[model samples]
Target: MRAVIGIGNPGRNYIGTRHNVGFYILDSFAHKNKLDFLPTKSDFWKAESVIDTFRFLLIKPTTYVNNSGLVINELIDNFNLTMNDLLVIYDDVNLDIGNIRIRKNGSDGGHNGIKSIIYHLQSDSFPRIRVGVGKQKDDESLANYVLSKFNKDEINLIDQKIPLLEQLMIEFIANGYEKMLDYFSKESNTNSSNLS
Candidate 1:
């Protein structure tokens, strides 16, 4: 089975926050596909379905952001999934807001969620889609910045790219990952998104 893990904190209190973009993306995709996220024995909300005989599971880790790797590990074992079969969707502050990056594998950079995943799995060889939340302002508290909701302009920026984000997610599902990276990379290049 193929699993896509969207790393973010749980609870209604976190909705619309910059840190919750991962959850937002997964929820949007699930809604588009007519799937409902149901509570699972695993530490995440899960939506399971099959598309053209390919089993797919969408996960939103309820373990919150910092300990995401624990939920990921559990899902892997429960689903008999390998690292290569998983794609993590997450937020990044390095890229410009509304930008997206796709990669087959790499270091977590400074992302605590990714760091947790790498620490738990002891490996970084997995696919990931990073949505840019833009760099924090110099005087802003990192924690405060990420946990805050996107401002009106930022929301407008991301809103314009939602369709493109959907396409990128679907590309991974339809074209498989290796080629999907190339596809997104090329797409980002032409559009100034920098899919690294």
Candidate 2:
């Protein structure tokens, strides 16, 4: 089974924060697909369903962002899932808003949650979708900036992008990273026009 893990801090206080974009995307995907996420004994909100030929488990790790790997590794072991069968979704500040970057394997690039995942899994061979949260101004504290909710304009952009990201995710699961990259890269280029 393929595992799609969305990383974010778990709490009502974190809802709508930039850092919770991962959870938002996954939730949107589940909603669009008519999948219900139920609380699991493993300390995660999970939804299991098959799309096309892919059998998938959608997971929102409840261990919070910093300790996300604990839940992810447990699920991986329990399900006997290979590294390649895993896909992590999380927010990245390095890219512009509404942009997504998919990488087959790489370092966390300063994302604490991803760092923890790599540390616990002892491998970086998994695929990942990095949703852009946009960079903050130089004077802003990183933590505060990430935890802050998006402004109205940003929210409008994100609202438009989430469904497109979901569609790209479906293609990623159905095809692979190369096809997804080709698709999203072109999509990003047309984002402005599409949003208009």
Candidate 3:
């Protein structure tokens, strides 16, 4: 069993913020694949899909971003899955816009949602895809920055990268983490800026 969780705040107010990029990416990916998400009993919206024999769950937490662990842990327990069975995707302000990084495991790097997941799982061994939301300007506070929406130019940049990102999400589901390291590394980061 496999699961992908996209962390973001739930509500119409947060719909277009940079912090919701995870949800944006996952929603678009699911849509492109013709999958529909069904709201579950818990604080999650879920859809199931398959690529060949690989069965995977696509989930977006309906909980606020900081409390995301509750949704993750619930799905983990209900599915009887290990950390290796999960892949998390979220926004990262540390990298430039449209950049993405994939890693097998690491510390949360000060992201509250990641920190909450680490706390609930008591481990940091899960795979993750970090989508860059770009660094905040010096004048903006971190909270204000993340909760802010992308500007028109930034959204256009991300729009250009969507197909590649959707492909990456599909590849992650089909290949797991190891098979595509080079495909998503910094060298490929440059390619994300261009559409094929």
lDDT of each: 0.85, 0.84, 0.83
Q: List pairs with backbone clashes in candidate 1.
A: none
- Lowest-scoring 10 consecutive residues by lDDT in candidate 1? 187-196
What is the C-alpha local distance difference test score of candidate 3?
Answer: 0.83
Put down candidate 1 lDDT per residue, 60-147, tens digits, no spaces.
Answer: 9888899999887787788798888888989999889888878877899889999999999999988998889998889998899899
lDDT of 2 by residue, 9-29 (tens): 888999999999999889889
Model 1 global lDDT (CA atoms, 0 to 1): 0.85
Off by over 4 Å in 1: 189-196
Worst 10 residues of 2 by lDDT: 187-196
Would you estimate the TM-scores of all the predictions? 0.93, 0.90, 0.91
Residue pair clashes in candidate 2: none
Ranking by lDDT: 1, 2, 3
Clashes of each: 0, 0, 0
Displacement of the residue 51 alpha carbon in candidate 1, Å: 2.4
User: Regarding lDDT, does 1 or 2 come out ahead?
Assistant: 1
Best by TM-score: 1
